[model samples]
Target: MSLDDKNTLAVEGGSPVRNTLLPYGHQCIDEDDIKAVVDVLRSDWLTTGPKVAEFEKRFAEMVGAKYAVAVNSGTAALHAAAFAAGIGPGDEVIATPMTFAASANCVLYCGGRPVFGDVEADTLLLDPSSVESKVSPKTKAIIAVDYAGQPCDYDALKKLSDEHGLILIADACHALGATYKNRKVGTLADMTVFSFHPVKHITTGEGGMVVTDNPDFAVRLCAFRNHGITADHRQREAEGSWFYEMAELGYNYRLPDINCALGLSQLKKLDKFVARRRQIAALYDSAFADMPALFSLAQRDDRKSSYHLYVVRLNLSKLNASRQQVFGALRAENIGVNVHYIPVYWHPYYNKLGYGKGLCPVAEKAYEEIVTLPLFPAMSDRDTGDVIKAVKKVLRVYAE
Candidate 1:
C-alpha cells in the first residue's frame, strides 16, 4: 500500500480498484420502511392524514423544537420559511454561496434578493464578518446554511441578525441531527428547515420540514404549505364546517401521509444511521490525516455533525494534475467521487441575474478542489476500504 508500489492507475489502462462504482450517497431502506408505506396505502386517509401530524410531532421533539410543519421537499420548506419571514420585493437576504442553489433560490421564491456571502477558508461555512458586510437596510433576513451537516457559527450569526433586526433562518437541510454549542440545529434559529431526501440522514421518499419556537411562524408555515388556507381538510372536517379561506398566496407544498409514515419509520433509525456515517467519516479522517495532498474540512470541537456528506479538499499545489483529472482518476477506479457544489452564483441563471465571479473567493477556490466521497449507513467496512485504497492510489499517482 506504499506510494512506491508502482501500481498503474486505472485511468491509465490498468485494472480498477472495484468492478462496480460506489455511489457518493444512498438511501438505506428496510422491511419496516416498506411496511410503513404499505400500511399507509391500506388506510382510509392517504395524503392529508394523521400520519403527517404524528411525524411532525416526533421530528420536532427529536430536535427540541416547539413546532414543525411538513412540506413536500426541502426546497419547499425553505420557500415556506422565507414566505413566513415576510420576504418581499426589494428585500435582501444574506446567504452563503457554498451550498445547493436551493438555499438561495428559496429567497428568490419569496421575491427577495439573495446577497452572496463568502465562507471561512477552513470550514467552508458562512463567515459572520462577511455577512455583516453584506447587511443593509434592505436586508430582511440571514439564511445561514449548515454546510455538509455541520451547523454554522450560529452564536455570531445570531448576534448579527439581532443587531440588524433581521430574521435568522437556519437552512439545516444538511444538519437535521447536528448540534451547535450544545443546542440542536432546529432550536438554534428563528426558523430551521430539514430535508428527508433519499440521500439525507433520513428519507420519506421526498419530504421536508420547518421547525420553530415561534407559534406565529409555525402557523404561517402550516398555512403556506397548504395553499395559504386558514384550515386544512382535516381541520375543516373536524369542525364539521366546509368553509375555508385563502388569506395569502401560497404553494401546494404539503407532504402526503404515506411519505410521513415512511418518514416516521425512518426517523426511528436516524440515530443509528448518523452513527454509522460518523464512523465512516472517522475512518476517512484517519486515512487522510497524514496525507499532505488531501485533507478533510475543519470541524469545530464544540459541534457534532450528522455527516450527510464526507468531503475532502485536494491540495492542488502538491498534485501534478488538476481537480478534474484526479476526479476522473477516482471515477476510473470505480469510486463515485463527486463535487459537493459549485458556488450558487456561478450558475448561468444567477449569472444572467448579474451575479458574477469573485463574489466569494474562498468558496470559489474551495469548489475547485473539494470532492465528496462514498458514505452511507449501508456501506460495509470492505466498501470503505476499497474507497480509501482507490483514493490513496489515485492521489499517489498524481502526487508531486
Candidate 2:
C-alpha cells in the first residue's frame, strides 16, 4: 500500500497524510485462542484454578525451567522475583534503561532502588562491562533486560553475579522464546519473568509469570503472589475452611485461570508466530543492510531472538527530519512506527527521585535514534512491504 492508497482511508486531508494507523506490535490471536478463553469462562473456577497451574507447567516446560508461578502482570512478576531475591528498601538492583518501565519499576515496588546500567551499543541488552563498573556494595541484584527480544550476555553476567554473590534476574518479558548460547532464556538467570500482555509474543489478556530453577525461590514467589498464604485459596475454599495462615506479607498478584488458559493456548502457537516474525525480520534486516540513513540492531548468530520489536537506529546527522519528524512522516503514509522507549531516568517520576539525565550515556544516545517498526505474526507480506516502502520513502529524502 502506498501513501496514495492509504490516503483514501483518511478522514481529512489537513496534513495530506493517510489515516491507516499501524501500531508497533499486536497479538496474533486465532480461533484456538478464542476457544480456550471460552472454555475457561465455562469452567467452574474463574481465577487461580487448575488452568493456572496448567499454564505454568506448560510455560515452564517450554522454557526449561523447574518451576513457574503466574502473576497478574509483568510488574507483579518482577516484584515477586525481587522480593524472593530479598531485595529491600536500601538495596539496589542494576538494570538497563532501555527496557519497558516494568523492569525497573518492579524494584521500586519492592522498595529497592533501580540503578541504571548502560546497554550495549549494538544489541541494546544490558552491557556486562558497564554493569560491572556500576556495581557497588549496595547492589543486590542485576535485572538484565533482553532488549528487542535479544538475549543478554547471561554467561558473562552469571560469572559476575557468582563472584559478587548477587542475584541475576532475567527481565525476559521481550525474549520469552529467545535463546542464549543455545540455552533457553529462562534458565539463564536466577529468576526469569515473562509478560503476556497483548503486544507480546503471547498474551494472557494482561498477565505475567515468573520461572525459576531454585525450589526455595519458586516457593517464595508462589507464596508472595497469593497473599503470602501457604495453601491455595481454592484448596481452602473446597475444604470448607475460611482459615488460612498468612506466613508473610504479600500482594494479590495471582493470574486468573481464565487468563492462564489463554496463555496455554497461545503458547502452542508460539513457535509458528516466532517463525513468521523472524521471516519478516529477515526481510527487513536485508532491506536495511548497507542503507545510508539507517542501521539495524546487531544480533548474535548463535542466539535466537524472539524479535519482540524490530528496532532501527536513525542516522540523524544524515537526515533532514528529526526522529519525531520521521515518526510523523511514517504515520502520515499510514505506516505505524513508534519509539520503543525513552531512558527510564528521563521520566518525571524518576527525575523527582534524583535520577538525573546523563546517568547512562549510551542509553540516552540510543533513545534518540531508536524506532520500533510495525512487526507482528498476523501482518501480511503487503503490510511488511508497506512499512518498508513507507520508511524508505520518508527517510531517504531526508538522508544526507
Candidate 3:
C-alpha cells in the first residue's frame, strides 16, 4: 500500500494506512509491573501502607522534590493543591484553556473562579503575557498545565506570580519526565502534579501525585487527602492513641498501596519510556519536514518534552476538506486521531456558568486546527509508520 498506487483517499476508494486501529496512547507494562502488584496484593495493607510511603519517597527523590503526596487520581491532586493554596470564594485562578477540563475545574471545585488565559500561537502553551494580562487583585494562583508534555515557561511564570503574590501550581499531568531550564518538571513550580493513568508515561492503574519543596504545603496536602484527619492508623498505634481529629474539610483522595507498588515498578522505567517517546517524536518531525499542509507544534530549545502527544496543526486553508472531514477520514482508515480539546469554556457546563465562546481567541483558533497523533512508548515501528502514512494520505486527499 504505497501512496503512488492510490489515486483516492481511503474515505473514498484507496488503500488504508493499516487494517488495525492504533489508539492515541497506550501504557507499557512488563513482568516487573505485574510482580509488584501481586506482591502488594499479598500484603496486609492495600490502601494505606508502607508501600504508599515508599512510593512517595522514591518519587519525590526522583524529581528532586522535598515531598510528594499520592492521591487517587490527577484531578484529586489538582483539587488538593488548590485547596491547600487557600483558593476559596471570590478568589480567581488563571489557567490556560488548552488542556483537560480538570486544569480549570479544580478551581471551581474550590469555590473559586477560573480565569482563562490564551496560549502561545507556536507552542500551544500558556503564554506568560496572556497570564499577566489576566491577573487581577482577586487572583490567588496560576494553574499552568504542561500541555502535551512540554514544560511551560516557568521562569516567566514565576516572575508573574511573584509580582502578583500568587501561588504557582504546575498541572504537570503530561510531563513527568519533562524538563525546563535544566530542572525537572516536578521541582519547577510551588507544587507540581503528575498523573499515572494508563495512557500516561507510567501506570498506577488510576493514581496521581503532587510534589513540592514547601514543607507546609506538603503537610497541608497530606491532611487534605485523608479527610482532614491529623493522624493515620499507623501513627495512632505508635502513640497508643485511637483519637484523631478532622481539622478541616477534606476528601478521601488517598492512593492505594497496590497502585503505588505498580507505580514504583513503573518509575524504574520512566527514563526509558520517555526516551522512546522522544525518539518517536523525532521520527515524526523528520517524516513531516517536507509536508507543507501540516505544521507541528514548536519545540522550545530550553525545554525537553516527554512527548505524551505529538500534535500537529493543520493548514486548513490549503486543504480542500474541513477538520471534521479530515478527522473522520483518518478514523475511517483505523488511524485513531483526536482533537486535544475544545476550549474549556466551550463546554456546555461552562456555558451554563456564563463562560461563553471568544473568551480565549488563540485557544479557540488552535483547537480548530490541532490534531493529536498516536505517540506512545509502547508503539512499534510499524505503528509509527502507519500513523505517518495515514496522515500523509489524508493530507494528499484533502490537498487543494
TM-score of each: 0.98, 0.95, 0.98
Per-model C-alpha RMSD: 1.9, 2.8, 1.6
- Scored against the true structure, residue 26 in model 3 reaches a CA lDDT of 86
Task: Please provide, for model 1 over 263-314, each residue's C-alpha lDDT reduced to its tens digit, 9 standing for 90 to 100.
Answer: 9999999899989999999999999999999999999999999999999999
Model 3, range 320-391, lDDT digits (tens) per residue? Answer: 989999998998788998899889999999999999989889889999999999999889898998888888
C-alpha RMSD in Å of predicted model 3 compared with the true structure: 1.6
The lDDT of each candidate is 0.94, 0.88, 0.93
In candidate 3 the C-alpha lDDT for residue 371 amounts to: 93
1 or 3, greater by lDDT = 1
Best-fitting candidate, scored by lDDT: 1
Worst 10 residues of 3 by lDDT: 1-10
TM-score of the candidate numbered 3? Answer: 0.98
Score residue 45 of candidate 1 by CA lDDT: 78
The number of residue pairs in model 1 that clash at the backbone is 0
Candidate 2 lDDT tens digits, 1-400: 4535533323223232334776778888889989999998998989878998899899999999999999999889988999999998999999889988878988898899999989889888899999999899999999998888999988899999999999999999999788988998899999999889999999998999899999999999989998999888777888998888889899999898889989999999889988988999999998889788999999988799999999999999889878888877777677778888999888999999999998999889999998889999988888888788777767765677
Candidate 1 positional error at 317, Å: 0.9
